[model samples]
Target: MALALNDKVLTEVYGPSTGTALRIKQVAMVVLGIAVLAIAAKIKVPVPGSPVAMNMGTFAVLTIGAAYGPRLGLTTILGYMIVGMLGFDIFQSSTADLNGINYMMGSTGGYLVGYVLATLALGFAARAGWDRSMGKMALAMLLGNVIIYLPGVAWLGVLYGFDQPILQWGLTPFLIGDALKLALAALLLPAIWKLVGDARK
Candidate 1:
């Protein structure tokens, strides 16, 4: 009986050990996710007139959230921001231009801040197990993207002045591209989760 009890205890503990191992693997994966996001942010697909560029960082963000859930997703994005602020050429620009704190607070700053919030939103959805369904995942990503856009547009208006022409230049032109990005992220996140799940199984 004692031996049987010991075996049962070991079985219970085994799941916890596996959980710990999974968490460790998740941390490493999140770090990799951050690096990929930084690279994606820098690779601009040209869109005319608007400062809006095709950034695939959103895809990485969603993937991280879907795979690891919320806390790690937020941490990974914050880590990316810290690295970029500390003179890493991880921003949209390829060159390392760390002039001052203001550099971090410049025009696209809100978008950077939004990355965290957006990840949190998606992460929460994913934690609720929405990562398996493409439609639900798409909605989650769409909402996440909106979270980014609201603050981004608000900051643009405040910094660049609340003029109609500024809205035209800053916000309007990028809508289509942002929509496409949302669609892409929606498509990619569930697929990534499937690949990870299959690998683990």
Candidate 2:
């Protein structure tokens, strides 16, 4: 009975083969996922002069990573970047250009790259059979957020002398907001996973 139950679970988790139809569906889903992520980028919390502002994109990134697994998550973020580069006007404040490149290369660039890494890391964690519990999801998001900041701060130090006062604009104000965003991602991602699970069921 236990073996039979396990088989049933596996079958449910990994759907039966549908060949081309499945491929089409996957493509459609990826396109839709990109659109959703674009919308997420549009929803921003403005911060003055600081390129780092809070946005729902991270939550969408977490959701995409969990739902589509690592490769798709990475692809989706790449898609987002491409869209921005093409002047989609989806990025919160700046449109894609040389200035955009500068912004991407600036202190926030690390965080941007981190978004890709975070998605891949979190998606891989999920694929490795991490429990879809809220706690685990929160921890994953938290770690991902932190991973990006390392590069962000390092770049900031390189761009603007590290010896410069830390308070005026060196990761302090952003900390509270980032934590809040992480908390928001933690709260939302699990609910989204559950909904996706229910749809699969």
Candidate 3:
């Protein structure tokens, strides 16, 4: 069956049930999630024909969303953005010298917004047990990417004029990278579920 009707998520499977311990776990998870997002953002590789580099940030974002579920996922993502807004070098294109509000309002702003949307999408999907199977998880990840790309491409078109090759600039270059990340997430999530299952046996 799906999720066993308990509403349990990956994090909750191994986490405390309630009380101060649960609160502490959630807060600590948010902190760790922020750290993961920051590290992923910085680990960028230049795309050969694209202005934007391919980064692991999306992968981390989707994984976090699936693992943490909607509420914690949203909290973690918001916290990450808050950290970036506070002038931290924790976004894909931000740095110590060129961070904060102005930087967030730049070209990549739409994708940042998309991260929140995709997280909720994936989180809800995971809570519904989509993350339990490889095929379903892959589909869920694909949906999340589409959610991310729509706003991202739209923002690029708006920011740089629709006359510009917005799809070429913001979409196509990352398709290959995103595909790889999607496959990784698909495989990784199901595999983790297996581990979780096996651990209890």
Candidate 4:
């Protein structure tokens, strides 16, 4: 389906859109988004050679951005970061013993920064109606992953020295997982839009 460039985001389409109701809906979405991020962070599998675990946190970030649009996407990610910064175990490698700023400054620090950029990128792509097409959504998801990994790999190099196998450590190991997520989001978002379109009819 060819959604208009100005089409509403998923959140906008389902919720109250005026005054007090809109504010309440936005607040509720932010809360729910944070919860989803936290839960996804914990659902991880170890990568044999990489310090960063394979996790669904990035998938949650991408989906939230595409569904929530820029304003709310940014808000939700910032809220999640703030909670993690406050010593909450709301990150992939975070824990009670190694939580807060200290943990954030570890190897995962750059990826954390990339999360903000990726969210904004996906949110804007969704706003432009890219999320309504499987091809466009896949491209958008690919771009979002690149946005994330650029800062992430760069940070790894800086933190661990350029001589280190930064790509192997930070980028290569995650490709298969990220590609899987990209494909899934691409398929899922367009399908959801189809459902919404059918429901409206």
Count of steric clashes across candidates, in order: 0, 0, 0, 0
Candidate 2 structure quality by residue, lDDT tens digits, 1-201:
221111111112444347886667656666887899778877877666564666677677766776666766677778777776665666555664543555466555666676788778767756643325678767877777676666666667777778964334536666776677777766665665565575434
Per-residue lDDT for 93-145 in model 3, tens only?
A: 78778899988888889899999999998899888888889998999999999
| Residue 137 C-alpha lDDT in model 4 | 96
How close to the true structure is residue 156 of candidate 1, measured as C-alpha lDDT?
Answer: 76
> What's the candidate order when arranged by decreasing lDDT?
4, 3, 1, 2
Off by over 4 Å in 2: 1-17, 96-103, 165-170, 189-201
lDDT of each: 0.67, 0.64, 0.89, 0.91
lDDT of 1 by residue, 3-91 (tens): 11111110112223367775776567667877888878877776676554556766666666655557767788888887777777787
Q: Which segments of model 4 are wrong by more than 4 Å?
A: 1-5, 198-201
Colliding residue pairs in candidate 1: none
1-201 in candidate 4: lDDT tens per residue? 754457678998876779998999899999999999999999999998888898998899999999999889999999999999999989998878999999999999999999999999899999998998999999999999998899888989988999999999999999998999999999999999998995422
TM-score of each: 0.78, 0.74, 0.94, 0.95
Q: Which pairs clash in model 2?
A: none
Q: Name the weakest run of 10 consecutive residues (lDDT summed) in model 1.
A: 2-11
| Candidate 3 regions with alpha-carbon error over 4 angstroms | 1-6, 198-201
- Candidate 3 accuracy as TM-score: 0.94
